[model samples]
Target: MASNSYCESCSEEGKPIAAIRFCSDCEERLCKEKNRNDNINESEKLESAVYEEVKNWKNHIIKQINTVVEKLEIDLSNCKKKNLDQVRKDNAKISELYDSVKEKEQELKFLKEHGSNNQLYLKLRKQRKGIKDVVKRVSEMTMSYKRTLLKFEKKAEIDLNSMGSIFEVKEACDIQYKPVKLQQAQVQLVRVESLLTLKKVKTNQLNLSDRLCLSDIAVTADNTLCLCNYDYGVCEIYVYRTYLDDLTYSSTLHLPSEPYGISILTGTDKAVVTLPHKSYVQFINTEHLKLDKTIRVGEGWYGITTTGDYIVVSNTKEIRILKKMGEILGTLQ
Candidate 1:
């Protein structure tokens, strides 16, 4: 709403006019038809509207920027918290590492200071040598004492015979003299018999043959022996009957490599022979002197043993267990 200007011509206030322009030269406000600055006034109003709209837009943009800044601040706070937590974890790990290093350093210092107790080490070594020397000296002294005892017995017997039976005083003395002679005879006979028996025992020991040496040993349910010649590369497996002390030779299944291990399968004539390389287990038909089936396995098989229902084989890396029919059961790495 706009108020009417003062009418200079009529000098009255009753006449109202629409918004128009002011005339400075005429000293009056005029309507659109009479005013020359009407266009200018309209232009000014349009410029004011544009300025107001621009101010509102600037305020909206500033509000949006503030919102974005606030969100960024919250995100920065969360990141700072995460960084602090990570730093705490890293610090804890560093502290543990430092403690470990400190312990190692302390060990090194102890080793540098007193790793070898010189006096104690010297004392122990001296004591050990002294003990060995004392043992040797004691052994020599014991042998010398035994020799002295033997010589004493021989000398005492000769002296007793020289000093006896000449002095007959009374009947009672004579009776005691016979008993004394009897006792001396018993002691001399016992000494001579003991010495003779000891000599014969030592002679027998020297005559016994010492040629028997263990060729091969096997431990199983039935203790089976396989004396394979390692130097000759011969495949002859000699099963020695321990109960009867007899050997049964089988040149049937020629083992490709030297027998690494031997295992007797229960309730079967089959025996598993492991070789140097991946030589499959050669089954020797014990009943007939013939080569039986050979159970296959992986390469580089070294050791072969048997558990309940499973034949376990060991290679460089793993133990491959298989069934009796050559199916791979499992592996233990």
Candidate 2:
């Protein structure tokens, strides 16, 4: 309704009464009402709506800041964790090596006192083998545990356009105007395009056991590959590492049954493997390359994969969706 128009009801009766307002809908005209000024009603509604939008804008900015802060915090924590984990592993290996060397020292001392030439020769050969093993482990750790320091980087130019402009309706017909929507801005992470050329940087043979079938493979956070080797009815998960572009074998996980499928759980130092013979999926800690507690799902599980939060496994007939806690979600045949 617009103000300052003449009242149509009074004009028809030879009374030229000034109209207080006119209703755009139905073209109704009305004169003054006692103690009533409805002229600013539309403006007040628009003002309230604008205030609401401002509040929403503030909330949106806060959410964006929180997201960035959380990411930085996570990065900082992961950096510290990786450094500490590496140092701890190095200390453990060095300690073991020292203990073995000390035992050999004692053996050499006794051999020098009373042992014959044959005993001393055999002892020296075993000591040489131990020395070589220690050297290889030290070399592998130095390469795999490369320090990743998290540093904060500030963005230079943020070319953010307006969310939208607040429009005022000049004419009565403009009251039917739809508010302009906020322009969506998307931030895309740089991804590798097609035509990816992958050449084998290093390829060294594994001294595999008899009847070993290389079932599945998974790469760990420390840049080591755990290869599942099915030997006869038994299984051995070989943890292999390549240090300085030279391949070296780390350790082995001797499983009770023939392991088939394997996948590293996202954002963790653990891997979930499917052992069909045991009829369950087992969790393996990739950090130490050892078995963690597992979800004992009964069946001959074949393929396995994880979706950040849930674990998915498949067998001969059906596919089972499960949580890490062994909660079965659904089964599709």
Tell me how many clashing residue pairs each candidate has. Answer: 0, 0
Candidate 2: worst-modelled 10 consecutive residues by lDDT: 177-186
Per-prediction TM-score: 0.31, 0.41
Model 1 C-alpha lDDT per residue in residues 157-180, reported as the tens digit of each score: 323222122232343210111233
**Model 1 segments more than 4 A misplaced:** 1-216, 219-224, 244-253
Q: What TM-score does structure 1 among the candidates reach?
A: 0.31
Give the lDDT of residue 8 in candidate 1. 36
Write the residue-wise lDDT of candidate 2 on 1-333 in tens digits.
222255667677767776544444435455664113345675688799999998899789779979988998998898889888878977898798788878879999999889998999898987897889878877887787655566778787644465567786676331121112210111122334688687877667788787789888888767888888765676788888856787688888887778888998889998999888786788988887778988988968989989888999998899999999999999999
Quality of model 1 by C-alpha lDDT: 0.55
Instruction: Give the winner by TM-score.
Output: 2
lDDT of each: 0.55, 0.76
